[model samples]
Target: MSTYTVTSFASASPAFTETTYEVPRELPAFHVFVDILACGVCYTDLYRFDAVPGSICGHETVGTIKDVGPNVNHLKIGDIVGFGYLRSSCLDCHQCTSGCDIMCKERKLFSHGPGGFAHAVVWDSRFVYKIPSSLEPKYAAPLMCAGATVFAALYNNNVSPTARIGVIGIGGLGHLALQFCRAWGCQVVALSGSLSKKNEALSFGAHEFLNTKELTTETVKAQPKFDFILNTTTGDLPWDLYLSLLNPNGILCLVGFQEKPLEMKSNHFLYHQARVVGFLVASRGVSKKMLEFAARHNIKPMIEEYPMTAKGAANAMQNVRDGKVRYRAVLIVPQDSSKL
Candidate 1:
């Protein structure tokens, strides 16, 4: 048996608790032995905690491969691997076959099994990815989820080098989206409700910053109509205002999941032939593409590291849920585990 740290949901008042779990000596299909070095807590993890009780919730993972099952030939012991929110999918599905496992009918998410928050994650090799030695594991964790999602959205939407892109909100997903957009050669505009984020947004590579509360149609008219807008805020946006900011055939893609339904004007879309699209992460096929793109551009998430054993781990989850983390929060497993 192996003892590991695990976060689980309680049936009563205390929703989340840290506990020790023992794993039997049997192996699951396609399971890889991963000594988790870092695990990034995402907003999605909070959603899982709220929606599913007793779930192991984390997705952004970075670790060293300790073992690979019999059928797994691509990965070996001592290989550095990373995984995003998705754990498994049915390859025979239409969405999976079309290079869109994000839309797979039987997609298995991280909450369904042993997630990144644990000391070791026994995951399917198909969901595992090799990481470069040059990139730090803590910094690379969020890219597996946040970076990959935004990168895939931008690339899948055909964002051009000359495209004017707007990244809404300066939180976790938005921060990384800003960097990806700027590095993609697109003119990036940071749109947020607070003026305080202006300087920080500029530091993250935004060419211009707009306070959405102070925004007017004149301000929208002054700048070039956006080719695309990446709405990364956890809440709903004023859809009419966002749609009006777009040019003909301009697209506004949403990556965040808001609690309530969003309202919008249908006439706005019809007038400009604009689109409001939503994308999750990428397929197993395109994840490599996303990582390679980040590797080439040096795009990575700004992460704050915490220890897995620290009392702050639970607080970090609440911080992410409350929108207090500067960008990303990663839980660092004990360094000695790296040798196990």
Candidate 2:
């Protein structure tokens, strides 16, 4: 019986601990083994730190295929690919058949096993996408999650090219949202509490930057109405004021995770016909399209890199917790396959 050992960083009580797992040589049909090259650290990872002790957590992963199982003709050894939040979904479900696999009840998430924070992982090949040759592994890591998410909001909503879009928060997700909306030919407005992000937001392609801290309800209502608004921050904000800034029949999409239940006035829905909708990462098809769109448009996340060591993971997590990571943080695994 041939077997191999996989090294991973598992979540501990206060930090991450090195752990190892043994796997059989034979993979299940339709699966592929990926030797991870880079993984992006996300706020979602921080949220799950203590949720399951000893569990590996990382969803934005980019790697090279090391092996492929029976029926896996689309991917081969040495092919560079990426995996996002979805692990696998039963293909027979209605949602899966319609290409919304993310909504399938039997969907297995990266949290189900040793995730991207590992030397390698075996996953259903259908959920993995080949990274475009133009995208470097490190730069492509964040796209698996952050980029896919914001892109889905636009793509799924059928946001028009002439739509006036507003992106709340200028962090990891918001930065990417700005670029995507601009590339799609929308009028992009960046909303952030701090004016310090104005220059960076504009550079990312926002047509205007509004400091939310300086705006009153009346002031927000007086500003030009947006056809769509994407909230990408976890912090609770004045939802009613945001709703007031939307044009009639506009959509306010929430992509951030907030612990508190949302509260907003009913007038927006009644009078303006405003819609509030939320979605998980993205369906597999949308994720693939997002990567291709990003590559063609030269959209990339600004990231800080750290080595994939126990100490390095701790430092990166701390930076994310302290709200210091400018845009995104990526963990670069050493390239030696022998060590892996």
Q: Highest lDDT: which candidate?
A: 2
Off by over 4 Å in 1: 1-16, 24-26, 337-340
Residue-wise C-alpha lDDT for candidate 1, range 1-340, written one tens digit per residue: 6643333223111245555555533556677878888889888877776776656667899988876777888888899999988889897888888888878889997767767776776888988889876678898899888888898899888889999999998988888898888888999999998788889899999999988997776666776678899998777667888888998999989988877888988886788899989888877767888787778878788878777753656767778767778899998887764333
How high is each candidate's TM-score?
A: 0.92, 0.98
lDDT by residue for model 2 over 24-56, one digit each (tens)?
779889988889999999999987785888888
In model 2, the runs with Cα more than 4 Å from the true position are: 337-340
The top-ranked prediction according to TM-score is 2
